[model samples]
Target: FDLWADAPEEATGHQPQHLPAPKLALPGHEESYNPPDEYLPDEKERKTFERTEPSERKQHWLPEKFAALRHVPAYEHFVRERFERCLDLYLAPRARKNRINIDPDSLVPQLPDPKDLEPYPTRTAVVYRGHTSRIRSFALDPTGQWMASGSDDKTARLWEVATGRCLAVWQLDDVVEHVAWNPSRDLSLLSAAAGHKVFLINPKQLWDTERQLNTQNLLSTGFAQAAAIASDEIMACRWDKPSGEQSSQGILAVLVHQRDVKQIAWHRKGDYFATIQPEEADAPVLIHQLAKQQTQRPFRRTKGVIQRVSFHPTKPLFFVATQRYVRIYNLQKQALVKALQSNVKWISSLDVHPQGDNLLVGSYDKRVCWFDLDLSTRPYRTLRYHRQAVRGVAYHQRYPLFASCGDDGSVHVFHGMVYNDLLQNPLIVPLQILRGHKIEESLGVLACQFHPSQPWLVSAGADATLRLWC
Candidate 1:
């Protein structure tokens, strides 16, 4: 897949020249230890001049002849300053709410989650305050009401969709790397990470393995890596797609190298699953599609190891956020789609909206982004909420809201809309900042979520704490 860069248009106005510039000066100041024609000291020169001044030395006034040099560079800095300030003064008033203020609270909003306290945004409440193994990650359902979290403790927990109260716990033998919920199923969840296996659990059917099996495999499984029960069809992954003559229970696992599986996730709504095999770079990792009946094609192997996959909630689109880039794909058409170049070194997290209009991704940059699907130019808004990598992101539909939690011990609530024509502000406007526990006092927030039908939110983290908000 290739990146889509903005097409260059014709020049806007007359071209400027590249001749050697004549030094800037006023009419009277011609030669001698002359002030720059621009006269004002640029920021750099002014800083140098100030840094050289002796603190203890007192300045003696020079005779009128030398008075010109006395003004010095800092004085020059005061004159020119930044040209943008003048442009700001001229432009701010004429701009719309999006341009006038970045934080949506300063101007207008289409829908604001009332739970968000504005101004200090007030950190008035403390939710679940305990957990161990450093809450490495967390996730909210596509519907936004329920929450799930994974920790280095080697376990994943399911919480009351609204209360942040632990409803049940599923244990993994290995340190959990990622967890996900099927966008179509509210009561079901999946946990997957580096152990070379995936788990599926249903709050209602946790005890009903056979009954759960009866549910549509799609109802049972999502694309694969973090295998959830998919639609009722026969679901299995075998390095070898079973031959028609051979009678084998639909294989349950895909064969890979001895131990190369790293991270994998399901498509938001489709049958396609994306995986990141354990190769560093330039190695080919397989990404395959499993069909319903026995056309029996071998699993497809493509170039490049898959790093991570995220699907559009309601569209036929899915994205692969990998070591090289973030690629959009049309699984049905089996064709490459849009690809976006991310400023972050490596993308650790990816989330899509129910409408497939916007995407949120977290990377090594310690920032979160809101990207408009229609506009491939760049991120509409970037959030500087964490000091380290952002491990997870979830956007609440029906409201201008989304939440992200990271290693920095904070969960940021973003409130803003995507602009199609002009990006005037950070699409993500931080509304509430939720802090995880200090290593000393309590626990941190590993993940956070919005309620599906109510105005509630929940979070989980390393402190072994789970918190709920309303």
Candidate 2:
């Protein structure tokens, strides 16, 4: 009989599959029904062993000294352990990653180089140094040749931009809180806000004889109608003519408020202006018409503490910034248009774009936020380059430049290109950081503004100096 040939056809190269026995089933000293106490671990050692990973453990099972086999508990993880063993025997290990055939550099957006975007304020050109105390605010006239500044020294000084000469100075009874030049070139008028009043002063010497006469006549004609106007028609402020020494100093008329005026913003036409008395919660914002000599409270009750107010360049929109929000109101409709949430702790300054489609906000949280009005109410970009609180922010009227000044004693200039095509997002590139003023008494730059016609920037600092960056 050919036994080998008949049994499985005598497969010479093949051997029986050897399946290894499980470690758990294999008998060892740990599996002993009644192991010695010395062979077993104490409670602390067992806890340490339990905490150790299963793969890192010295043994697969713990040693237990039981009095009887009936006291032994069943192995809870026996089925799981056997299943894992079966998987290891059947399945093969694998490693894979999806590959992409694209260049890494192409993923980034293309932006214009800062060097290509010129005509921005790159260096300090002039420094006006007359204020005995910190300068609070300043403005450039429509011609861009003259500048007006309010200081804590209870004075407002006019300066010639090129020579840094103090052309004139008007002393007030209290610290000058704010100052702004009328946007009208036909009239050479300046507004100064001090304690409880706003002075409409015509610096007659700054302009020619004809222009000065026209400005004087325009301001004088308002007083003739002031007496005829009813008192109740005026909201929270009164238009009163300055007398005695005030008239000689070019003070044309004074708008007296119940509370101290903190800010003054003029409309593009120069006939209308607005003032904010933040202390008065009920009547904080007042709009005044120069020709009518009337003061009107636009809002019956302001929601929050007023920080700053601004006017749209070409629209009838008025921007009122509170602690953490900027509310826009339409003067014609007398209704709320949009409320911008700045996402900041406390807003220190607010400036609308010349195109009126964007907004710039500075906050005490050391952030400068840019908002595209067409986009979300949240900031389109939140920049935090300042080491201290941001005190001022401004946008150039005729340029694609924006600047922010902070308590860190630095002014960061950026090239903010707003594209006409709505599909293309605005490109912002940091240009320069101009630093010169020394920090004084926990404060640095307090206010900043751009020139009306030129790419010049003027910043008023708590160091009692105004720097012109061109």
lDDT of 1 by residue, 1-470 (tens): 23565434543245553343333335343223454446445678556656665553232111122346665333333434346456655565442233444785657755545455332223424364334666655667655545667777877776545444676565555776666554445224343553544444444424445533543364324334333324321233333322332113222332332244465556554244454555534232334343331112112454444556666666676677775467887767867788877676777677777567778888766878678767774776667768766766876655667788776767777665554455453345557776644532343455565656544556666666666654
Candidate-wise lDDT, in order: 0.54, 0.88
Model 1, position 337, has a per-residue lDDT of 81
Best by lDDT: 2
Q: On a 0 to 100 scale, what is the lDDT of residue 320 in model 1?
A: 73
- Over 1-470, each residue of candidate 2 has an lDDT whose tens digit, in order, gives 68756556456448664555434356767669687777788989889988999899866787777778798889887898879778866684533445989988799877777778887888889999999999998988888888899999999999999999998999997899999988887888899999998999988658577767777888788877777665654657888888888989998898889899999999999899999998887788888889878778788798889999999999999999999999999999999999999999999999989999999999999999999999888899999999999999999988999999999999999999899999877889999999999899999999888887888889999999999998
lDDT of 1 at 10: 48
lDDT for model 2, on a 0 to 1 scale? 0.88
Clashes of 1: 40
What TM-score would every model get versus the actual structure? 0.58, 0.82
